[model samples]
Target: MPAYEFPDRLNGNAVNAGDPQHRKNLADVLALLHVGGPQNRAELTRRSGLNRSTIARLVGEMVNLDLVRESEPRETGVVGRPSPVVQANDGIVAVCVNPDVDAIAIGLVGLGGKIISRVRHKTRRVPSVDKMISIVSKVVQSSLAKLDDECRIVAMGIAVPGIVRVDQGVVEFAPHLGWRDEPVAQLMEERLGYATFVANDANLGTIAERLYGTAAGKTDVIYLNGSRSGIGGGVIVNDRPLSGVHGFGAELGHTSVARAGLACYCGRRGCLETEVSLSRLLDIMGEASIDPDDLGPFVVASKDRRLRKEVDRQLDVLSVAISNFISIFNPEIVVLAGFLGELLEVNPERLLERVTSNSFHQLSADVELVRAGLRSQHLLIGAAELAFSPLLNDPISFAQLKA
Candidate 1:
């Protein structure tokens, strides 16, 4: 027998194979119930472009697997026609982890998009590639052990903070992690037994929003996650993440907005990140004699008459960078994550207004700029979404492979 690994063990068989019509039919039904909420058989068939018989067969299989539930029948406008709504079952869970910035966060997520359990652990001082994976693996194992064995781990997602070539499972560059061209997914697969996926941290955040957060199904979305180093942007257009031919399409932080300004982590000067990122903003606040470590006190000071004036002055520079972004992407929504989102919560209308006033009138008119809903969990949840993505379109494939 092949060397077996605990927790990552697979049953060594191909995923389920049903008729193409059945697979497509089931996907449509799940998509409708997932995106549109519980719907009756007739509505599912109508929305999915499938025949009534196909819907019945797929729904029957789903009900047997406990992936969906049937609700009480309700009367429709058509006389004597009572249809029972089919609802998604939240028991099917996915495990996700974010390994970055010297910490790992693990979350158990359900199909209905709820986080069942979440925990965070420190990485101590070690920073090797193997050590990072081990940290995440341990956290996952511990979390899974807590759940009943019947609670199926449908998939796993990982969000790493650097350039991630998902197709290759190689993290090409992570200056912060001190890693270069590491096959993280393969390592995890060998170690854990379950399939895995890796993605750029910010890109995963975009998926989190598209999957369960506010940006669901929007054709055009630009997501920007902030940090002291810079802000990373994820672009989705026409229902796909726009990773360029080289899989690095949306590196917005490197875009030069000023010819003469602070140098960025990527060795560039006056990039938008140098001016608008949370770290840069904190640096500016420090110049005003505010203590960076005491962010709570500093925020309170910011609300004071004299302190708020200084903060607003600094925001003016960042607003210019956002305005430039508006002229280019013209996205329907731009989500701000990381520390910037917290700052925005403290001063919502101000940042919103600043971007609008600075951006082009026409572009700003249609664009809605907002902060991330996941907050500190953004990277962790994004990572989980990445790990689980490969299993989404093929439920039968997973069903065929027994544990």
Candidate 2:
């Protein structure tokens, strides 16, 4: 038996993989590559505390199953031989889908968080559930047709900008998308014959950041995203998501900022999202919209006084929310994505200053505030994590096991 120590479980209690034949043993090895990217066999032995023979057998089994591949080691001027590098197989794919208020993105994501291809279909207006499903099915068909012969898509994941019932994969309410009680995962799985999972888009973003983005190694984190529709958020506590029992946790946009300012879609008044908005920012910029990749710089370099004033006010409202989150969670890092990230880029110093003023003195001192490093593809990669969850857990079933 090997000592199975995951990065998140390195607090001195590494489990012992009970038996060599048990799938837990296989999963432990796979999870290492799946999360940590790649490593040599000797490094794997050091990490797993397994004998050379056990690590070799596990790597061989993974290679035969098409779950991983090995490459010759590069010379580093060391005196001894270097172990071969073993990496997760990128041929195994996950179909990722995200339905925003203005567009829908469908992507083919391979293992190791590689985005093979993505198609973003723009919409003139908010799409109905049936229309959204039709678009997803068509794009998925077109995307899959171009897959390489060695590549296989195992499952589909949907990231929704709305209240989601994760277990049911249903959109309980997406005020911007105008959806209610739609079983998106069930509907898609029935249409495509692949297992499907769904979650709140912001929640997925949090997981993606923790695994592959800015908050890679941090456990406690607070993430806020501003989109065309509105603001959304996610929180991580002690390495696990703080998603509520009903899956409505971290709806920071609805956090009341004013007692009698404006009515919201959730039947609330003066919500944080009501004050700080992406569409408003775009409208102030005197255009319907610009590419998200361009919005931050555009906002930062603009010469309009009105735009600057409105942005300052929006940032003030946002600071209140950020400070409150910091006081409660005291996370090591706070990531701002989407237009919220743009807001930071526009006037990072001003926003952080305001946040610090509102926050507890000690709590505000050490917390790091930064933009999401993944940029426009954060949500898509997050959705892929959802689709890839099952394959990572049960590699034996998906294995071809050919000679």
Candidate 3:
């Protein structure tokens, strides 16, 4: 519930590429603060594996940078000292942008990993990337203006629904957005005047769950976003998303289930996206003479039945694909996020049953199929986390910031 409770430790303001000893001491202090919450000088020294003198010196610097703060004293019975607490500061704010189908969401996230402000702009009929970036920049600028200029706008994380070159800051392709080799980060930085990070929207969603949501601490996990555009996936191994050699690690939508099936945007036939995407599902229903999205107010208004059936079919296909993933990756958790995340909440047991039935017995035995705790905000939160994470490292400075 409190901020700074994400998967990995914070970066940028916490740890920098400084003297090894200084960084180690800072890391110790951070480890203590993260695990035990607020602690005084003496408590920090004891838990951080650092001496009292080292803690005193390091904490003084942190205080000056507004990265850490002192708290009131707490008394222990029969104790001669009432130790004052030193806590990690949660004032620093970062911006997160998620460019999705319906709209672009911008969120102001604090160092403690809590969202402080959020705004959404409709994509409208013409969802140009330029328009989306402009809107996002305005929202971020407005949010930052409210805080101190020294508020450490550490990083800006963006989630795009396309193939991204993480190190290159290039979007190789985005069929839905009609984008190719677009320098999204450069465009955003040009508009906002801060470093920007771009990642696959679905991958970011997976990171969102792995860092702050239900999949925390899991060694291997799969995050799936089953939306109308497509079903995207982000695969995590040892707490890191597998970006692959070319940054296209998990393209779940393009994976083919039926060898000779529906034509996909990728020039492939019978890809999973063609069958499981909401748009495709609607088409399927249309062919079946079942206007589930149109008829049945409960089916349309609530639309549980229609969605459930479609999700079931998708899950069946997912089961086969996931079964292969499990056999290969052997992940501990396979998280279903995105629009289907809401649906899973309504029929968890049923969905889990199908997934379990389709997965390998040995692999499915322990694998958990769960819905994401974070909803539409998953990608947004992931972006903030991506930027702020590097800042939270101890003895933090600009050098330790990631690209």
Candidate 4:
């Protein structure tokens, strides 16, 4: 796919707060380029509602700071002269890492949401924090070594499938991975010599969806991602991920779906994750081991009557949880990702029927149920967005920091 310009700006406003207008202007311009693609000075002025002089000054400053570039004017085939196109500088790249229960994926993502390179290490045994750090650092170093002289690694973003303390770059808890309170970002920065940010994988997934996926241009969205280990949830209210003070607000999997169902790893009974997790489904199908990549085929090939019944039962339970979420959030879009996406792809009509029938008429009628747009790469792209966020908000300060 052609790389489109869409950077996650959900965290943009937090940076450069001392001079709000300057930060806002820079963020606005960057967001415009990210969403609308390259634009000329005239187009930017018209779209941003800023005067031509201000647009010119901002564009010039961005170009000088190496945050943006001005391409030669392209013919419009109109009566007027061609306008010089302005776009985000592709030389700036971010190192993105996503550490999950089963694997670690590292990649180099450029400013305009392009994945330049990626490597994945899958392990049968869960990896420790130290093991993950070593693997990720090596991959990042190798990726960086391959970059051309003009390319610069600005920052690194880590997406963990757990409760994250965003400010501290700490993984508060990841039940599936058996991790807790790990200072991941700090360790990465110390080891890799780059500024690092860490966040919950599903939270970042929602940001990816809003900025580049099916939920792009939509205001309210709820995203649910399922994997072999468990489920993670994210909520976007007015385009911002609803990260609570501790950045652990949207733990949707822990939400109770069954009052007397199976016990959850988090000590909860009948949690959404307990009922719909890929492991549970695989177990129901009599599988001894779980392969995250082979889930869809396993389900499709299963002809056991007991397995089919269990699948339908799980769907029924999942529908109840989804219905409750719809009543509570009333999101414009509900995105089912990963294994959930596969489930929806195979049985969208059945899943939709269950959810809509269980939900309130007015609320469920307008909500669009869709599969995730980005597959395995959602969290990685979201991590890159986190790394690119500060520069997008204030290119001048970022340039100074680099110097």
Candidate 5:
């Protein structure tokens, strides 16, 4: 409901701002405000293990850098004293782009995980790599032109539905979009002149959930979503994305679920995407696409025996994959999005039952299956996280604020 909330634990081993440690101190305080919502200096002092004087100085520096702002504390009946609250400045923005099979979504996201503005460009056909880039450029330029001079655009992040060499910002493969070894971020950075980053859409989704969605404050999480193109997902372990050494790991969509099912575009049989498809559900619904809000109601209100049976059947197959992930990852929560979310919405108990029975470690760990909290905006918000990474990691350098 809120744009962002407090994490279970603040990350970063930031000590007191002693000489070189000032950067870490600034990073730590900023991280608290950015990830854990607004808080007073007292709370920051407790969490960061910094003295009041150090925290006051750090917060003051960030305020000067325009990274955050302080507001008079709200009056609650039980409060002894209301200290000023430090919150991220929404004026600092990042350009987020996500190009899927049917549409290219561009959003301007501010600090504190706020979605300032969003627009989608629908396409009749799957646009090529070059075509998508062109569209993104147009949308970004037009959007930036409308912003006032105070609106600081620091970076741009693009989420691709493929294996990305995140360190290099190159897309190794995107079967849905028919791409390979595309230097998408580099091109955009050269054209737009802002720092750019590229990442796997599902990986971004996983991070977004941890940042502000259902998995917020969670350490280990599993996120899977079924869209028209296919299923894509990501995993989080110990609060870090399990992106593997090459950033090609955690390709959850292609995880083989069947010994021999339908062949997948990735040269595999019975891939999760091939087996559990959104198009199958949409075809049965007799619509090209269903509204995010209407999907559950339509499934619930409809008494069609065929639809009910199909939903159950897909759930049966999907449960096997979910259980497998639970056993392996031992995640606290498993997030299902898009059509898969519709499955959970229709019969949460039934799906949970199936997943529990199939999971090897079900008896050992309490795993909760939930829907994506950010819903349709998860991907865009996820892209925003990547764009915000640089600043979150090093507030001093990102803002060019020296000690």
Candidate 6:
């Protein structure tokens, strides 16, 4: 069995791990820091139920390993001496990638969800797998060269806009990108010399929301991400992401909303994506050539009657889909991300009113419909989280292996 297989037993109770007590302690400390964010030594001791002496020793060891840092002491307002704040070391960074049809976004994300640096590479045309790999590898090499020696690139994570077999790190299909059965993670690992994980873009977005955004501490959520080409979705149930049997379950955009609507690139008619995608909205408003980043301003400033009618039509369709999702998943939160977020920010009342009226009262009453909290960097942060998961879950074994 792998050393990382040990179950989490850190709930204010001591476990008899026999030979692995030290490892358990290390894992528990890291897990607490990751989940609870930065905390003082006293707070860590209280939350982990570990004795102060033990926490101090483990924290010191982690600090020595360049995994945790202690801030300058601050006075506690009482008669006691000041205590130092403890936080995860920012020097440990992960490479995060978000690949889209027009460009690829790459970031160096440090621990504690900090995006230290980022770069965007625009392509004149949709690049092939080999071409994308070459371009991204060069970008990654350049980024690495500019980083300080203390900033270690521990791992890499990629978010692709399509169905992915995450366990195998293979992109099963990305219709928009015309990619199929691509071993993205393996190829990236070979090129970058770091273990890589790949996941669907929307799924990563959902993880970001749950970890550090609007859906933090939420058990059930439905997330929708709108892009120029299409929309993507993810579902979280009981605090766990519901990636279907093949890790392609929450393709909510393809759900049929109209009986005989526009044709979709997925070879379906009336798919929700065809009706409500950003590209479709732009096309209807006669701005098909506008840059995607400028879409929010374009919509806000346009007085086109066609755009108004199209927005109204799509809002109704979106309401129907969201109402259906509410009935099906009974989620605690529904997050609209990307262009969908802009849509909500522009006219939240229209969508909210439609959804509330359409959905069952009892179900919709408790569901909070809101815009995405993470905004622009959610996907990048989500990828970093993927790379950080192994260490957060099994810090001791990971440390041992690395050493």
Judging by TM-score against the true structure, name the best candidate: 2
Superposed by TM-score, candidate 6 places the C-alpha of residue 28 at a distance from the truth, in angstroms, of 3.5
Model 3 residue runs over 4 Å out of place are 1-18, 27-53, 73-85, 144-152, 280-308, 393-395, 399-403
How would you encode candidate 6's per-residue C-alpha lDDT over 221-286 as one tens digit per residue?
999998754899989888777866655788999999998898887778998888887876766776
TM-score attained by model 4: 0.89
RMSD of 4: 4.0
Question: Model 5: per-residue lDDT, tens digit, 156-230?
Answer: 888888888777788998888888899988888777787788888887887788878899888888999777668
Tens digits of per-residue lDDT, candidate 3, 95-125, equal 8887756567788876656777877676654
* Model 4 Cα shift for residue 3 (angstroms): 21
Residue-level lDDT tens digits of model 1 in 26-99: 65576567546678999888877878887888999888766788988876778776878898675677777766
Across 100-185, the per-residue lDDT of candidate 2 in tens digits comes to: 77888788998888799988888777888777788988987888788898888887888899998776777998889999899887
Cα error, candidate 4, residue 73 (Å): 3.0
Better of 3 and 5 by lDDT: 5
| All candidates: TM-score | 0.82, 0.91, 0.81, 0.89, 0.89, 0.90
**Which segments of model 1 are wrong by more than 4 Å?**
1-18, 36-38, 71-85, 124-127, 280-314
Candidate 4 Cα misplacement greater than 4 A, ranges:
1-20, 282-298, 301-310
Question: lDDT for each of the candidates?
Answer: 0.67, 0.81, 0.69, 0.80, 0.80, 0.80
TM-score: model 6 vs. ground truth: 0.90
Model 4, residue 299: distance off in Å is 3.8
Q: How many clashes would you count in candidate 3?
A: 20
Local lDDT at 153 for model 4 = 91
Clashing pairs for model 1 are: 8-192, 8-193, 15-397, 16-397, 156-387, 157-383, 157-387, 158-383, 159-383
